[model samples]
Target: MDFDRKQLTNEQLLDLYKKLLKPRLIEEKMLILIRQGKVSKWFSGIGQEAISVGVTAVLHKDEYILPMHRNLAVFTGRDIPLYRLFSQWQGKANGFTKGRDRSFHFGTQEFKIIGMISHLGPQLGVADGIALAHKLRNEGKVTAVFTGEGATSEGDFHEALNIAAVWELPVMFIIENNGYGLSTPTNEQYRCENIADKGIGYGIESHIIDGNNILEVYTKLDALATSMRENPRPVLLEFKTFRMRGHEEASGTKYVPQELMDMWAVKDPVTNYREYLKTEKVLTDEYDEALRAELKKEIDEHYQQASAEPAIEANLSEELNDVYKTYVFEEVNSKSNSENVRMIDAISQGLKQSMERHDKLVIMGQDIAEYGGAFKITDGFVAQFGKDRVRNTPICESAIVSAGMGLSINGYKSVIEMQFADFVSTGFNPIVNYLAKVHYRWQENADVVVRMPCGAGVQAGPFHSQTNEAWFTKTPGLKVVYPAFPYDAKGLLATAINDPNPVMFFEHKALYRSMYQDVPTDYYTLPFGKASLIKEGDDVTIISFGAGVHWALETLAKKPEINADLLDLRTLQPLDMEAIFTSVKKTGKAIILQEDTLFGGIASDIAAMIMENCFEHLDAPVKRVGSLESAIPFTKALEDQYLPKARFETALAELIAY
Candidate 1:
């Protein structure tokens, strides 16, 4: 392939040289600023700028690029204004995240570059989603993602590569093998001969190249980009390079050997390209000095102008202003007013109606297409909506969420189903870090719905049953909904799909078929952050959600002497604290019930909130009843003892007596 490759003209080589020089100068300037205590820290790619320059030179403006911190040259090649970059570094209002985040942690929707998060692996999976949208739209565009050798050791890296190969998506997985993962060496990271070899097993084309040479990178990437435009296949290209500096400006290369540093310094990409330009007659002594002077002046001016911009003022009152998009509930006509419906059937109907109403809505999960999902919630969906709309995904949870994020960014609503809630830990990074922060950082709507089948009591054991909504409720920019009855499940799931934010809809596994109620088979969206007052009485106020609501209701029936105002907190994230406060004020006592463990559960949070708001009106201390602080067992007897019905009855009697 090298023998058959075309040579680059002198003019083209010169352009690549200048592109490499700009970021090198910026890194050098930033390093000085760090020494002067002007900038906080910096991640330099002094020896690997050619990788970014070569790749960005071949990409179109409309195509997307997700760049890591070391790949700052990609922004320069994309023509993003230097002042904006400086403003971001200086933490000014003119910066990308408006000074909310530091360094390469922001994105521009206009440039189609999603700013990479601090975590390394999620971006690769997210790039799969962007490529998926391009493929689905028949757009002959490719998405290029940059990461290092250490990132490939992450599970998401393998998940991203596997799915990209399986789908034959137009994605370029570029790995800059700089031989270090922060302080850890490459050998300690993986046992493989090379990172590119890992891609070969995924059935994708793999290539390794000399990353120090600017012309070599540009020529090869140019050819690869052209071929992908026509054939649309992912390419795993490894750029063998070195990190010339420490991980950041503050941390010097003490962990790196002096001999290794001396060896890589001789082959520095920027200096090597500068000499290559001079030898090729593209630069003279005077021109080289003038170019350096011009770049330095420009970098200095941008830094000064960005530093003079207004700094963002701290305002605690408007903290949650842009955390979630404001949603207003609108009336949707009921197609059928039937009351006889099971919870699973109601959820299926909601998904079907929403898909039929909005042509852009898509449902994706493992065994969802023909097998109809693990519990058959999305069964028969493929036959009705076709496999494209009702997609059967590979068993990669992280990729599934990333694909949904990519779809939402491209103006599509995605409904993703995790086979069970216990498995959400596998996909937690994208959901919490990327999808949850998109709106707050970029104001971009990631309209994705993750259907979570949670809770124990069906003998699914610790691996399958989990009520982990508490973990997500504490995270900002996410909506957590747990419905108890069929009516709320159908209405809330419909609303969640239509809502313009990332939503986690948790449906208890035990209530899927056991809980039946008269649900309206219509297009209606229930308002989030509003609790349903199941029964109103003033003796005591009981707060519950999901399967725990049934336990509370059962306890109330068992002890008819205890008059309680039972409130169902439908959405836990945007908590209905107003409803809670009102009920607590009337009753003068409160009891919080949940199916999760008592240690650091939703019950604990709600009990605190009640104590804060109604401390004066309290007749007694706020009581909380939840599952035991242990994993849910396989046997029904142990599971029953672990969960809350018996505990709730005991707590209810104590609260009434108190």
Candidate 2:
């Protein structure tokens, strides 16, 4: 379809010219600064300004855009103050990320922009989440995400596209085929005719356009965005473009053939748009020169102002703050009414109660809706809450986790379940890189709870049985919760769901059905960082969590002579060191138990802390007991031997005798 030039007024045409020109001028200024050592690095979008400018210009302000490093025009087109962006690049406190991240690696909620991480494709999943929010609220808003052709090879790209297509989400998957992925050419990347063709495989409407032509890009994108708002669905647009410079300033373009450079040089988006406007009498040569001069002056002034701002100071307390939003527990009277229930039922009750309390709570995972998940934890959720809130997802761990993050971005709380604990390794990048770092990087709350059904006991073998709590406990900006009893499972799950930071809630598969207790019927929450004192004595302190707590209980019951102070640590990230110290001080001996291997488990960390804090009070050395360092075997006998039950019993007796 041809672009109707008559559709735009003369003033709007002039404004588009300015939008295309400003980023080009800014890139030139940034290059100068890089040469002068004022700026460290830059991803040049020098020749590809039209794609960013035209696409952003066509979108509404309330709509969200996730832009990569090269799309500087997206920021400029969104009317973000030049000084603030400059401040961010200069590592000033006033920048969007407050100097936590560099360059375009940060996002600003104020501008409805979600910035890219070093891993390019995760943001596509995040875009799906934002689109999911839009679809849920019936907001008629579309989410636009930008990526280079090289990133399309990532699994997240396929996952995000398939999810959007399956759900018919309002998302625009925009790809800039810039001829190279760092030094590798397009032919080496994929065999498909174009990136948009891959979208067709996913049943999405795909289009290809001349990226150098500003009019074509603007008109095509505007029509697509309008249609999407009326009928919510995903579309892919591939803009065939060229990289005018190296990937970054340090990487020289010695690999590009001179002929290709010469060919693309004349087709520059900014320069050709300027010539077209002047020839059409929309902009005079005199006005064009004045506009260029004005843009240069503004860039220089903003750089100066940003450079003059204060740099970040090194303060430990201040730096440690804002990892999580402060959650104040409401004081509720303890109801006398209670009923005996299994751990699985208690967790289900907690989720049902939380869903009743918060209208924005959403639950998603594989076979979770009608099938009620692999373990039947969400058995009746679909019937009670409907399929919209309790969603069934494809076997895409990475995308679903990121979508949950996106939902949290729009004030919705999400509970995403991993079918098995061992499967979390597939989605580790987004969890560790994006969800765990977003708040610290840009102060955006990732209100997501990932339910991990973990631990080894049911002969499910290595693939199904694994204790992965230690994986997330070491990561900052994340909460790790592991419950032992039915009561603690329900209360802590509720607390984890309510917290404003990302949480990894580990449910031991072995304890899900075996453990039972009288759980409170009414809504309640257990605070994190507080350990439940199950039994108190002076012989020794048995510190453990999850299934390890059960083993410790069995050991104590079998040996009636040995008295011990048993503590179940409810949360690992916010560890209850105070309780451990108090118990160790009274007992003067301690033993840490865990289901993970003994080589590098959380038990070692707890033992180290106990020794460091309560060394003088100890009679015997702090004992550490964990599973054998090998993959869990499927046989019942081998599985029992692989676990830490026998080790915990031996360690407890040895510590008491010592």
Candidate 3:
């Protein structure tokens, strides 16, 4: 599309100028706030406001925006009130996050803008999910996700772009080439001439434009946005500009050369745009003066009013609230037995039943379609639910989790599966940083379940076998469930999918086909944060979860004289503290067992909780039994030695003797 001044009327041009000017002026005032010690930091969007404003102009009022910290003009162009922006910066009680987060890292559903994370690249994949949902719903909406040239080097950039391209999602991936990423120059980062060139490999249309040229930015983005809405294709756009100030008000920026700064100073976007408006006779001198006065007075008044508003007081209870959504499922007739089933079969049945109950529920993972997910857990799902709902995603962990959250944001329940537990490290950023924090940040429903095949008894080596539930147990706003028996696995999994929160569901790979139990055929949901007592006794209490529960139960069975009370914790995050306390108070001695490494494992946490609550009832110190700190080996001999039944039995006997 060629830039033609005749395309837009003078009034439209003047309106675009105001959108560009508001953020520039607001940032100037923000810099003053930093200097006055009111704000701790400021990421100035001084020279790049034109690009964000132009992109936002092309988007509809309800279109979603995934913006970074430097794109303040997006809020202005999206019609978020200036006073709210000021209130957010001032840390007032009326801020978007209730003053929980500072700076540009807060978003509200009303504005359709996602709060930015400092990592800068994870949200692009999330944007892909939102676009995917819009396409599925036949909604004529597009998502614009902003990032920097430096962030494009991150792995998340490729994962997001590749999936978006392969799915033909309606997303506009815009990169702001501001010469430097924090302090590193673009030349030092990548040898490519343009970041948009990378988009060609994914079969996406790429565009390069001068970000300082407001007309070019607006015209190019407007054309792409219009075309993508109908055609449903991802677009990558790179806009060249420069950062006029330090990375933040507190950053020294000594590495930036004075000569380069001087060169960019001569081409300031705000000054250039004003000059162009005047040259086109779009703004008379008197009109310009009055516009400037009006903007200055409004901004000053907003800042003063926002600053005077009461600061949010520290509230421990409120901070802990809204972490998890409370869900209620009706109870059916209680039954201890119905028909024998394997763990794998029970899981597949549970998933099938849940999907049948909820029409909007979706399941996505690698090779989960006809391939049945590496483990054949979803063998007949595609035939039943169709390929649209049982999506087979690319080999990208971050994209899998992020896209699931995106779908959840658009009112769909997603069950995302990580192929193996050890592979979760690749997708940890989105899981820990974004999905786990989504509910707390804006009280949004992150109604997604991430299933991980875990445990080490399979001899699949370090790459496949792992028990990493302890990592998620420490993270707030996530529910971690690991069931030991087939009945528990089926019942708990049904609850996990129905409940409205992000759940990290760990399924022990070794227990899938090896364990068999009579599970109820009827639909049911087990209560979260409650434990199941496998055996009742009074000499000692054994607490375990997942595969370790079987190990401990067997150990106790062999030693009949111990008279142990065995407890199986179904959920790790919402732990059954009451169950632990009751059993500990009865038996007086306790043992905690797990399949993860001994140090920093769930066993340590259970031991700590027992001591904290049952100090007076204890007859001996709490004992923890788990695998050694070394990684799981490949050979059967070494793997057996690493996680041996003898280790657990020995620990159990020691606690009994003491």
Candidate 4:
């Protein structure tokens, strides 16, 4: 335990022994505490203490550590007291997060540790981004990211490796391949014989080590850590170990076979290493017993201190958040003109105009650089503004988004596309955790615009076709906009990019090429949170955005006998409630339409909003139109059958006839 105090001596090998033993002892103490109902949450780094201490033995305290959930042992290996770690586990105010974070999500500037993100694969990008910052600042420190074998399957892992390798970042991507990612065996996840082999695709040095051996783990990580700090390139390390306990408390290990457990339990790093030390004459029975006693005392003192700290406070309510701070952002009001322009051209021109006005505006996405984006939204953008501004990514949605947030952190208007909006789920964690809370937590605004090709009418099936705008709709501190026409698309995109908060700007794939409306060439930006009254009527309010607007217009054009007020909600979150309430109040009847699924769709949210604020003003019940509540089928016929366009005419007929 004393070896964790920083200063080491040649005769202090016994103290070093205590350092390795402390984490497991701490975990054992926490486990008993759990049984006694004193501790609520804890990730036991039980069997793999060697991997944590051994690897961190070579790492400097000043360097960055993008630790995983169980890597709290590494934090304990350093100067972070067991009390604070346990306080974090107990979700108490004594922890560095002061009770704001859940288990393993707490760290501090003193630790030089980036807080652990619970979601898999996101740390790869956050590690890469912090490394990117170190590189940009011309610092020599390195970033070591801890992840699991199962996380390698995530797109962000591949993308982070590709970006890190290409940039030659000072990072070590370490995979604690502990046989299973929450009971899903590694064999089922990847075909590569060794986890380190995945690094070859990224052109980085890869090492597979006997992770249970302290000497080997330390030596391998030490050499790599040296090369990483000097060469400033990425490295992948596969730590072959086993999880002695279930992935989490209250987690069942029924999925683990007895044969596999028998095979791995013998190779348990802590037991084998302890025996190895005893057999090698490096440690004595007295030394082992004494180390255990000292570690126990430290654990006891820490727990007592943790239990005595003040309880969690409620002053920092979740709603009292500053998601965007001191930013001159005005809500956009839509302006209608008798002008027509192509949706694709509107997007391009809008970005083009924004780039002209704002010097720091930048765009990034897959296929955006060479192909000018999959739908030509970035066409002529790279050529005009250069590749640095309109950069292309390697199909890593999570990393792509986190990188955009990183860009925004240092003052750049980052606009990233998720290709098809359906793929946005891949980056959901970063959007929800980092992008959404960065302003609130760090008290700094990360002005980033996330653009996606959304909706399901194109018959692209489950993977490519989806109207999932609502996935992030309920996520406060984020502004989501659906640009319907060329003019609206252009103006809103400009507005989103310039705004100092994360914005999801969804462009319908069907509208990209279908509708044409003239957009002015003048460099102008629109405000956020505004709606456009496309067509005014006194009978009913057709509430929609994106493809819904097009459907409403077409429906009205086909039936001149039916009068409806069409209000386009240019911005979804921080919705144009004024316009929606006004139009619905005027018409006294409402029909909400969106191309997303009816289950968890934005229509339901709009309906709830109307019912909450404008219910008494309504004459008839509010109705919603969206995709059926089922997985989008691959067959073109089935896909069409599942899409809103197939049912739009019928719904409109019924609504109008009523």
Candidate 5:
């Protein structure tokens, strides 16, 4: 059969063959290393080289591609140094992740490659973010993300595709249908005859192609990417192929049928492509053999150099250093002009001021755009900043948060709001796994602020009334800020947005319209890790944040004779330990209050820290006041009893008297 190069020249055709053969050679070498115990593990992409190579060949250098564990050619085809890749595989200090993660779990921003998380589906939403950034900037850059057929069952896949289609962002949702996801076959994965048909539900153009055929893969992607760049829109391309190996080297392939393996072996992409190149006169058999030899030599030399590099040192401080970006807080001038503003308006003003200052700041939520959000915090934002800056997302928390991380990847700051804090559970995986760990793992900051309206008082039931700040305070890489007053709310929010780390900004829904304060009219920022001294006295110390601050104040106002130090811990993650210890030592008595339930609450941690640090200065035992350990009831009467308001008042009285 005569080879039809189509629009590709002879040089391009030969280059594709070289790209296809390199990963196959690299995988073969890696398998040997695995057996020799030089390499720990590998997700071999032996038979599936054509999909990554052909797709990467069609993409521009500036365009981004998020590759999964099985897409090794995407890295090699992009001309990333072999030494660096080998260094990563060998757990060397010179690797992309500094030996923090194994296999292809790390990404390099220089190469425009976003590595996939183990979840397998969140990267699709991240692709939506990168594509959104390109669309927002009119960059004409396209993003391609890969996933196996089994990951199609994930909600993130559907959410990301729906978001990309709705926004008309230039993205290629590449599904490498490699027969099985781990041990489960594609037949058990989904009911649809073709994964491409799932794209129809999302309004995205879909196609199924012969993934083993390099010419078909390259030609189709080239035309599709060209059209997408010219007129931005998302499309789905399902590549029918087989995984040729186990999920990982250790898993083994006993679950796969013998006939299936034999059938795919004959249709091997690398061997077939090599034979085609020879038949087309692009290379002789001798030249092909020489090329393979040269590539093997190069891989061997690179591996040797990488193996000689130093391994990661076990330094405790160094290991903890890059978890968050160091932020220098500029003290706001206290004498700045002030005006009375509600907590909601204060947050709105802070967001408005931030949007005005940072051109790249984007706000995303379900009803935030024209609907003004659930609390009406951004009532007129869409009218002022337009829809692009204030994007209304679907009811997909996982995708929205993942997209926020994506926007941060390309030098943009994003603020993602959960309608109510309770709904954040839907977005929990991305927040804890990807957003929190990206900086620690790869030295890349996911500069995102997730505004969670938390706490209970309005009888909104179990779902909407959760005070889940404790959920993330235990997370290492995230910064947790829960403000009590309008002044602190505005200032802390400004700081959270400016800081180069993921922040969980908890806004108590009960405090939105209830509290009013004289806040700074102009832009200002309050430093984190500092507690706000709401009131100063000498008898007892009351430590709290968010709605607990108000309850403490109410209790303190009623007891004029009982002088107390009211400390509003503005940020939870960067807990004001110094302030806490100082107040606890001075008073020699402390009562920690929280809106969350008593068991496993942040208040318990605070109480423990107080006892640990201020054990010597103990006039009385440390006391904790929190809501009952039960789901927040829907009735106002039960809610009042369930809340910590009465409990806090009693605890403060007992502490003062003791």
Candidate 6:
């Protein structure tokens, strides 16, 4: 099993010790940063560094690396700068996102850390994508993705593994079994004895390794990683590791049972590696002390430099480049007013036209090819395009997105349809990490479009009909668009297909069947980041997007007391801040609305914009109309109560009355 396993030389063993030590030191330093008010919070990679470095060292440099939040060792070994790493934790101007992005989404393409996402299990799907790309390009590289034991229980973990096994993808999935998901032990969550054993259903080679033993992790992972690269098949490994420190900055170990705490305390990966080196007579005290001091000095220097480093100033003018190439989006502010086209028909026409225009464009998803998508947006594509391009996929959200990204990386315009937007959560990682990040990391963009039916009318209940747009709005590098009228829907969707980036094109299921404004016969596309001013007025600026725009319009029609200026951000990601600023400036009032939950939604960003930049221009406090922070309910009555309604007519009156 271990073809290349060798007895480590004294120097090699010393290197393992040092690698393990770096994580512990970095984690502790991060804890100090958290306490000193330098960084907000962090998850420690303390007891799991050996597996990360050892496994990565075995894989080829061109091979992909997808690691979860707790594995900074992958970033460190892959050569992600310590300054950028520490700056990410500090949440300063120099932070990973200029303090705009989440903390654990670290690593970059420069490191060949293919894609990194904080959410659990999703990395497995992204690894599938990287492997698929390797297969297509005839490359002998493997894709290595890591996850915690808890991530193994996720639907994405199973979905990705199944597809990789089916395709025999060149992938080595390593489960970093660090004993717990926060405080809940693996035993409490998963019924399986071992995460590796769970791979039996997928019919892939799997192994369990002593993750605390650097040699074991290195030898086991190295063989599997090499085998996948050379032979090009899927393999799975479970690294039995531990967590000596608390889970994250928020976790205090207050809930950990004293018995299990004592059980794992002695097996700390860093401590184990240090002791193993001494026992094997591999390292001298002098070499060890010098290495420790050098690492400490390096850490201190990088922290100071990164903390003080100026933010990566992206020119606002250049922000357009970050979203789309100038040629893809030609500014044409006029909404289509020509005769005769229903909303659903417009969507179908748009897809057909785009696919016909670009030979690279292909549609795939459950029932998409043959049945023509859940709502028939892709009707007749399979018959015309052939199964190779318009093939139907098995019902696996993770695989759908990951595979689409793979196709996109190799110059394919992949369009995936989630049966409903609420169901898109299953593929959230691939959308955010691979589809969204490939361009930023490798400086190469993907033309991937995900058409998800969203919104909460027609009473389809919670699971089938709930708006989940903002779930994606939180993630950068991905465009989220929601169109109200048939013309904008068709135009925006067409624009998204042409753009060289991932787009969450939300087709409101509620509006899909509704006969709205007439669309033009001539195929046309609306540019990204431009909003439609439905009614320009100086009374109250009702800033909205997607389904909310229609709702705002209807409310304005019925009420005489208020004349609202409606701005529909047809493309959510490249938000038209200029339009927002102008509207708020003139109207001297802002009321943001959407069908998603109020807490942590995109409306918050709009509110923050108003408060920070346009505070002096506002005559009244900004108002937001959205569902209360809770899961969507199943019953019709509860569903009505869960969404942001135009029935908030009284609320609008109140805003204008102020």
Q: Show how many residue pairs clash in every candidate, following the order shown.
A: 1, 0, 0, 10, 0, 0
Query: Which candidate number has the best lDDT?
Result: 5
- State which candidate, 2 or 3, has the greater lDDT: 2
Model 3 ranges off by over 4 Å: 1-3, 325-337
Model 2 TM-score relative to the real fold: 0.99
Q: Estimate, for each residue in 491-522, the C-alpha lDDT of model 5 and write its tens digit.
A: 89999999989999999989999999999898
Worst 10 residues of 4 by lDDT: 1-10
Residue-level lDDT tens digits of model 4 in 1-658: 0012123343444444666777777777778887898877666666677777776778888776767778756787677877877777776766655455677774465676665566667768867766766666676768888888988888778888888887787888888888888878878888879989888877888989877766677666777788777778988989888787888876857888888778877776666666756675667888788878877888898888988887876775542655555457655443544456678888877788778777777677888886988887787787788876777777678887876765554446777888888888888889988877766553446678888887766777788877778888878678888878777778778777777888888888887777887777654567777888888888888888888788778878887987888988888876888998989888888898887788788888789989999988987778888887888787878877787865777776776657
Q: Tell me model 3's lDDT, rounded to 2 decimals.
A: 0.86
Colliding residue pairs in candidate 2: none
Positional deviation of residue 265's Cα in model 6 after best superposition, in angstroms: 6.0
What lDDT would each prediction earn against the true structure?
Answer: 0.87, 0.90, 0.86, 0.76, 0.91, 0.76
Query: What shift in Å separates residue 349 of candidate 2 from its native position after superposition?
Result: 0.5
lDDT of 2 at 401: 89
Please provide TM-scores, in order, for all candidate models, with all chains considered together: 0.96, 0.99, 0.97, 0.78, 0.98, 0.69
Off by over 4 Å in 5: 1-3, 332-336
List model 6 lDDT by residue over 1-658, tens digit each: 1112286566666666666777677877888888888777777777678788887778776666877777778777766668878877665555444454556664455566644555566667767766776775578887788878877778888888888887788888888888888888887988888888877888998988877777788876766766666788888888887776677867777777788778777777676666656665666678778888998999999998987776566567654355433344654443445777778998888888788888767677788877888888878887887775676777798877977765665456778889888788877767776667655543557678888888777787768877777778778678888888898888888888888778899888878887566777657888778888888888988888777887887888787667778888887787898999899999998888878888878888988998898899999999988886787777778877777774456667888889
RMSD of each: 2.1, 1.3, 1.8, 5.6, 1.2, 7.1
